[model samples]
Target: MSSHVPPSHRRWPAKTLAALTIGAFGWIAPAAAHFQELIPTPPLVNQNTGATVTLDMTFTHPMDHGPVMDMGAPKRFGVLVDGQTTSLMDRLESISVEGKAAYQASVPLKGPGDHIFFLEPAPYWEPAEGVMIVHYTKVVVDAFAADEGWDAMVGFPVEIQPLTRPYGLYTGNLFSGVVTRDGKPVPFATVEVEYRSNGLIEAPDEIFITQTLKADANGTFHYAMPQAGWWSFAALLEGPEPMANPQGDMVPVEQGALIWVNTQDMPQPSTN
Candidate 1:
């Protein structure tokens, strides 16, 4: 059999072929949930650097994989312990992650107790969404088994008050939290959940990238993590007031109350 093929159809570079195929289908992956990731070096510090914990802060979509967005200097950074909060903003150091502006800070754990480190990032101007984005994020570190202050709130415009213990959990435990804005429950608020990807898992569909759930009348929701890794729950709501955009026009604020908790796989029974 003799057939003549077009010159362009004879051969193509791998990269060029990929680009052509994608362009032909007009294929685009789903946008990931915009999460303010305040991940500590160690989710739990048993014995640490002079009782200090280092945290890496970035803004990105954790589930759909990242095209990490640049994070500006945070407005506030602090830790709450024994019902009291102390400012740590002066400790923030400029850094880069995935080629985007990010921050790193070390928080000193002063005593035998659980400390909740929280950050109020400067409002990020998301041009695509045409609104300012801000995420008030918090994570808990337990020291010396004091086991207190895990339920304390950081008093952001929006915050998550954990109903379940925020730490020391095996995988498959039910994690629960109450969504609050201004110290009041937000009835039926929308919450988005994402797992910190290990780069080996793929989403079955666009909708599967960021799992969504609605809170009950009391603004509480819960989920059982299927795998062992850091999981984030974000409760999103509208800001109280609109902020002026670059064009000097008013635009709504997209605010989020995000919390991170880590889980470990259950140990198998030992055989004698």
Candidate 2:
């Protein structure tokens, strides 16, 4: 997320504007990773009755850990279960994080199965990249020991259909998913991976800010977590149509299909 300086409002020279919009260093602005996060408390729901889960939705760089961007009200929020979807957008409450606008919501788990929570946020304008971003984010919460429906797709413009069980993953386990756009596999897609670095981990360099990989010809990709924490996988693709910026000009729209998964460490050996 870069500064939202509309070109119509700036008097910079054409060459300087091009350099800034293209993200150069020093004289130009560098592109930052934009991630729409929908992190849920407890990550899994064990009980059916009186089981309420809270989700924190925000736009930020998870690996970088700070400079939270303002997130407008989400356009869509819902849960998919047993091939059915329910809208929870009305339940979202305004929340604040890092002195920026964010959102939070609580969902009561009344049935036994996997509840797939999804969010489609309003497009964020990034002047430095000269594009708007719309990330369709999702997370899976297994309820009452039921194991079904973890891989069900909500049918967004872009989304990740998990090949591995999203929940119950161990730290070293390999996670995989297929990147789909308009319900079809997107071959050779770029997927960005980042961990929620909660001050315990440090990047060796800027290259480690967002670890990226490409999906296979069939649109499947894999990554193994190195430690226990929350990790996000974002598949970036260009939208079919451009969107209107504040300047009333048609600009590129970057659509991201993102999923968050939690991993736990193996048990300690004989601490007692």
Candidate 3:
């Protein structure tokens, strides 16, 4: 049998070939929910440990263990303690996570109280979804034995105000918070939750990767951690107005109010 094709049938146009290839392989997969991670190394700060805590800031899909996205310098990064906010932007050190730009900082605990660390990441242009994503993210670290200020608000455009203390939680504790935008509750807001997987555990299905829930009329939502690890709660909403993309076309923006909390397993009974 002849392996050669006739001259008339030989070459296909570039557009035609590209169309055929795409039809065979299908289009790109849908975009997964993006999470802006602002994680503290030792989630809890206490007297037994050191005075300085290291925090890692990365944009990723935590449950999937990433195809980490490059992150620009944050618009704002700071800590709030006892009704005062201090800027930590000057201390940020550039780093790389999964070959993508990330950041880290070491913050020293000055005294006992809840240190609320917050980050307003530069708006990320997500071509996959044709929108910009800006997550106003925060996490609370309890210093020494002072748990009083754990619920203080950071005053982000969109943020989660914790109804339950944000730190020192057991694996099964119910973490609750209210979704607020401009300091007012967002009634019936949508919240997404994901576990910071250690890459050892596997999701049985794609649906298990990110858990979705809705807040009540008061904008309060709750979820009990099923495993011992860090968990994130993101209350999603639309930005006030469309923002122009790089191409100078106005597009919608996704504003996520996110908070991260850590949970640990209860200590087992010691054998004598």
**Could you tell me how far off, in angstroms, the CA of residue 118 lies in candidate 1 after the best superposition?**
0.4
- How would you encode candidate 2's per-residue C-alpha lDDT over 141-184 as one tens digit per residue? 88887999899999999999999999898999999999998899
Cα lDDT over the full model 3: 0.85
Report the CA-based lDDT of candidate 2 relative to the real structure: 0.85
Model 3 misplaced stretches (Cα beyond 4 Å) = 1-30
Clashes of each: 0, 0, 0
lDDT of every model, 2 decimals: 0.81, 0.85, 0.85
- Give candidate 1 regions above 4 Å deviation: 1-29, 48-50
Q: Which run of 10 residues does model 3 get worst, by summed lDDT?
A: 1-10
lDDT of 3 by residue, 109-217 (tens): 9888899999999989886466788999999988887979888898998899999998889999999999988999888788989999957778887778889888888
- Give all TM-scores, in the order shown: 0.87, 0.88, 0.89
Give candidates' CA RMSD values in order. Answer: 11.4, 5.5, 10.9
| Model 1 clash tally, residue pairs | 0
Candidate 1 on 117-203: residue-level lDDT in tens? 899998888765566888999998887778877998889988999999888999999999999888888888888899988456797
Query: How far does residue 97 in candidate 1 sit from its true spot (Å)?
Result: 0.6
Between which residue pairs do clashes occur in model 2?
Answer: none
Model 1: lDDT to the true structure: 0.81
